[model samples]
Target: MELDILAEKENVICEMVSNLYRTKSNDDSEIFTSIYNQYKSIHLQYSELSKNNLEALKRGLFIQWYQKTEPNFLSGISDLEQDAEKQIVNNLFTVINTKQVDSELIWMLNYYNSWDWVFLNYENFRRFDTNLVNEANNRLPENIDKKLMLKRGQMGKYWLSLIKYGSTE
Candidate 1:
């Protein structure tokens, strides 16, 4: 898979987790765990992919694995820009509505652990963190204006703050 695609998937899955958290329902934990588990597998695969297809995987084309295996997988979450967006939103809605949180923290921890994988693992990726140069090497395609990586960074900081001071809001 291309790095951008993986980054995009990470964005989608993170959005799904955030949406699940927003539902005000009791099932956020369960839904979070399920999605987190799927994310873990992808992380493992990402390592393997980074090793084998260093050049091609940067494109994030590897996400096709989930698209092929899971039913309405991406479609069940939120709307994506490159592919169909609403499918992901729907997928996320389905999971949260059906389950209860059992091991939600596990996924949350894994998500935090994987942060370095998405941002710090690449060669020219550091450039993106500084200035948006190297068109082909940018984590996201130049055409998309979503600023997802920025949002994720904000969310990550917020979560860490929650762990340190706690969320009073």
Candidate 2:
């Protein structure tokens, strides 16, 4: 299929994921499972496209979804960070960046990179607020990897700042 058509389809999938997140209920495992299955199907369909086209489609869809949903969706509570929908979207982004697209493509998307866009946009980003970060730092386990924790905390803070300040930079 053409890149435009594939992107449109991916946009639909993003909308579905967004709706699912918005309407999530307690004990939503079954709904999440079904969404995961649907994502797998969409992934398979995109696998048929040429690598460049697939990358373009993913990038286009990412921008489209961001523009369409960022205002309300970015700050809303959702299990998106741990959800299969995020996994699938991130997988596509990884594939496109590592396999299909070039440096320029990376530069373009790097402003609102996929990792920050998906993982950091979760409600949990608030946990890394400065007041809470110090408390979290004090509670860290002795045997735990402090470096990893610090890096994650920094990422969380960075993402939170971006959202709170409304600047992708």
Best by lDDT: 2
Taking the tens digit of each residue's C-alpha lDDT, what string does model 1 give over 1-169? 2555555566677668567556757756566556756555544444445333432232122232233333433323221132212222222223334432123222332332333343333233321221112232323212322243233322333334334333332
Q: Write the per-residue lDDT of candidate 2 for residues 47-128, one digit (tens) a residue.
A: 4332335453444334333433454233221222234334434554555546655433343244333234443554433222
TM per candidate: 0.32, 0.34
**Could you tell me the C-alpha RMSD of candidate 2 in Å?**
14.8
Off by over 4 Å in 2: 52-103, 108-169
lDDT of every model, 2 decimals: 0.37, 0.40
Highest TM-score scorer: 2
* Model 1, CA-based lDDT: 0.37
Stretches of candidate 1 exceeding 4 Å from the true structure: 52-169
